[model samples]
Target: ARNGFVVNGALLLDHDEDKLANVLPRPNAVTNRPWAVLGVLNGDYPRLHICDRTVTFGRSPDCVVQLDDVHISHKHCTIERDGNNGSALVVNHSSNGTYVNSRRIEGTATLSEGDDVVLLFDRIDGAMHGKALLGQQRVVDGRGYPVLVGYRVISVNLLA
Candidate 1:
């Protein structure tokens, strides 16, 4: 099916070392100030939510953004906005991996608006993406899911 092919195609990029994200530079955290707002979107939870001091994202019920799916890990990653400055760093704790803008991050990356954040990309498994899909025509036919297991950074610091 198209969804399977789309998901599998994204997996292929992970095999190439050179294609992955380079070592992340140490985050220049400025203060304990939390980000004013940040949005995390996916198929199920398409509505954006605001951020707090730090958010642990994974399958665990304790995680602020709990993604209870097969592809997600218990403690997959954490996106922290610890400084007054406008910077949010995502630290990967899952062996399965995390990708920002389609490039796998071995450590962390400061999120930017409009970045595609895919979690556990290898296991999308054709699950329906709900409202986070594209292609009006394709959607009506049951193939409207995104190309990966992910969320969209819809906003950062309240910026669209």
Candidate 2:
């Protein structure tokens, strides 16, 4: 005689501030509702909530998710709100590249619920800071080649 039922998975709950922020766009206005949350598959970082129309992740301070991975480019990849359906779109803009579900992306990809995403890097150039020099082989064109760094997006939830 069990009093409770078994739930297969864990559910993480967080507010989407960006959706609330969009309501008034005023600097003084404070919105606490979050549109979506990205749970990291294997990392110490806390869950990421979608707090902007376009959320960027990379080594650069300008990026929303400023990862300290040497292999990551300055402006690696972006999660943007799709204009047609308000869905979240994952786009790769990194020299190292971005992967969704173990498959490398060509241009843009629509994210499905519980889809796996990985930020890939072959070699690291600390100087690039996420921006590779303009070339095919794509070297940092600076000093200090660092180690490889990558991130995996374990789960994604879109709420709008």
Candidate 3:
């Protein structure tokens, strides 16, 4: 049973305090709760990066630098949720491109847990750590439906 989610950087450096510091704070704070954060260490720089409610284009967090010279333009991008089981924060590519796990996604796509999402613009890609399942889904069926029953579980994973 999982109660909380956290995203952390995978890169390990003995002296890199910034890397060790939790970047999820801002995202979590803006979102008004604790969430899972994905830590990215190596990859092409993304043009548009979404941290919670903030979007960073052609720029990295104050303490962090772009991994490479590649830059992505931030335009015509949006995030949406899929059905009741899946969710996605998507980028609508105009002239540039958006890639998820090396595959270029056009229009819309559902983001999974631990997916490498990148928005490409000007050869630079903004990297994002996708966090999923911040909370559980509780369905309360009060009559109407046939074979309806009531039960409670200590774990969200087991509810499904």
**TM-score, every prediction:** 0.56, 0.58, 0.37
How many clashes in each candidate?
1, 10, 19
> Model 1 over residues 49-129: C-alpha lDDT tens digits?
333546676777656555646767988988776366757677898987887765779988988767766774432355535
lDDT of 3 by residue, 74-99 (tens): 24333433335424445454355555
- Index of the highest-TM-score prediction: 2
Q: Is candidate 1 or candidate 3 better by TM-score?
A: 1
The local distance difference test score of each candidate is 0.51, 0.51, 0.32
**Model 2 clashes, total count:** 10
Worst 10 residues of 3 by lDDT: 145-154
| Superposed model 2: Cα runs more than 4 Å off | 1-31, 121-160
How many backbone collisions does model 1 have?
A: 1
lDDT for model 2 comes to 0.51
Candidate 2 residue lDDT tens string, 32-150: 44455665543333455554667777777666565566666888888766766867688898877887765679889988766666674333343425443223323221122211333
Whole-structure CA lDDT of model 1: 0.51
Candidate 2 residue 134 Cα shift, in angstroms, is 32
